[model samples]
Target chain A: MKSADKHRKIIRAATKVFAKKGFFNARISDIAKEAKVADGTIYLYFKNKFDILISVFEQEIGKLIENILLLLENETDPSAQLEIFIQRHLEEMKKNRNLAEVIHIELRQTNKLIRDYRKNKFSEYLDIIAKIILQGQNEGKFRQDINPDIAKLMLFGTLDEISRLWGPGSEEKVTVEDISRQITAIFKHGMLH
Target chain B: MKSADKHRKIIRAATKVFAKKGFFNARISDIAKEAKVADGTIYLYFKNKFDILISVFEQEIGKLIENILLLLENETDPSAQLEIFIQRHLEEMKKNRNLAEVIHIELRQTNKLIRDYRKNKFSEYLDIIAKIILQGQNEGKFRQDINPDIAKLMLFGTLDEISRLWGPGSEEKVTVEDISRQITAIFKHGMLH
Candidate 1:
């Protein structure tokens, strides 16, 4: 298999392993077996389990960022871009529940080193949303006085909490599109009348 | 001394010990030493170390809930209530950084049993916010169509993310009132023009 294909396979396998056995307890040998590759092949692709975990995050969030940027390219209105930004984010998380579980729960339960790494990796993603907020303000589509950092954190934090609660046994029975629209409505227009 | 006073003292000392030594490594003796009480005395107030941690959360968050309810008693406006809610919440966290650090970071990094207990304790606080949102809708202060649960999550999550970032040397250099107003403005008005 190609290096890229092998890399992708390792990530896919690792996501399942980490999600099932958890990040700390999960061994590279387990991931290697799941990926149908030799143990040494895993080392060539990733430095270690920590590298694999970070790689999974970087790849997953990177793809979501790419999708958001691509979707925004054809859209002109900042409101629309913001709405699509939320929609695509929920859609991405919903599409990969295993990855979402790891990112949301397992990674958080890791050590200080992993937590710092997660925070570092997450900053890049936050910058993407920050830029969107900045653009919205520049276009006069968003509130000019609002701090873009706070606004971005509001948007990210809400979606994150929602996604964390959005699991197998949600009583609300809401669809992804439904949730996306609800979140967009709240963000675009305040919850108060 | 009264049983309640000793109980309070034990919790206070445990919060400090847990914050310093971390939850997993913290022992009952360390807490007893800090509280200046006998090891057996702690067992009278709490069943075990885990029980002490949960009680610390219960007392801290319980007091916060009580304060929020008390502040909202005279205020009829939903927006104002929400603002005060955010303010009091931030103020409490600010007053006790060690406890805040333990609650936000250490508890999350603990075992599943602790995590689940934390979740259960947090739901009560979320319900308080949900009631405020529902009351806002009833009073025509908030949008009628917005989901109270989702809005509560937004408010809580935003404040949480902000607190996590807020520390001894934060880059923002903003006051608690400033952040409360910024957050309240977003929840009450939103980002859109």
Candidate 2:
């Protein structure tokens, strides 16, 4: 296989290992066995376990943001764009529980450096939400007085917390599409009359 | 000091130690030393390190909930009650940065048993928010169609996320009161016009 495919394979295997055993407990050999690759082959594509974990976050979230940007491009209404963005996010997580678990649980490292990296990746996500909120404000859809930073936190935090209920090891029975609808409604219509 | 005071002293010391050195790296002897007590004295007030951590959570959060319950007793408006609740929550965190850091950063242990305990304690918090939401719905202040559980998550998660930006190690310039006001406004009017 090409090096690109090997890289993807290693990342996929690492996600499972980290999600199952957590970032600290997961061994590089466990990931190698899961990936059906040699231990040295794993090193060829990644620096260390931390590098692999960071790559998992960077790659998965990068794809999510890219997908949201693509979906937002053809949509004229910022509100509708926000809705699609949320819907696609839930759908993606629903489709990939391993990825969701790794993103939610395993990424929470105790190290300050890892935490800083996670924060940077999270800021990228917030930036995407900020842009959508800004567009909505400019278009007179969202409230003009709302600060984009605060608004983005509200939007992102809500989705993230709800996602926790449906990720791997969760017992919540709510369907992703249904929850997404409920969320969009909350965002579109204020909780008060 | 009395045994009760000793219990409180140990918790306070552990909070500081845990905040500085983290949960895993912290030693029971360190807590005892900081509290100015013998190592065996800690076992009298607590079972072990985990118990000390849990007690810190239980005592602090239990007090917070009790205070909110007391304050909510006199407030007729559920919305105002929520505003007060959010404000108090932020104020308490602002007042105690050591506890805040330990709760936010150090308490995130990957152990399943610890996660279970955290969830149970968190459920108590969720219950408080749910009651407020339900009360608002009954009073026709909040939308009756809103799911109290989801709404609670949104409120709690939003505050929790924004709190991270202002916690002990955070560099964000936003004040606790100002951010609390912004959060309350979002909970009330939301992002939409």
lDDT of 1 by residue, B1-193 (tens): 5578888889899889876666756788899999999999888887777788888878787887887888989998877888889998888777787667676555544434565775677788898899988988888878888888877877777876777656434565678898889888888877888
TM-score of chain A of each: 0.86, 0.89
Candidate with best DockQ: 2
| Native RMSD of candidate 1 (Å) | 3.7
lDDT of 2 by residue, A1-193 (tens): 4579889999989888887777767888999999999899988888877799889888888888888888889998888888888888778887876777665555443545466786787688888889988999998988887789987877776776777777555688888777888788877776786
Error of 1 at A62 (Å): 2.0
Top lDDT model: 2
TM-score of 2: 0.89
Candidate 2 per-residue C-alpha lDDT over B19-101 given as tens digits, one digit per residue, 9 for 90 to 100: 77677668999998999999998998888778888888777778787887898899988889899889988887777766666
DockQ of each: 0.54, 0.57
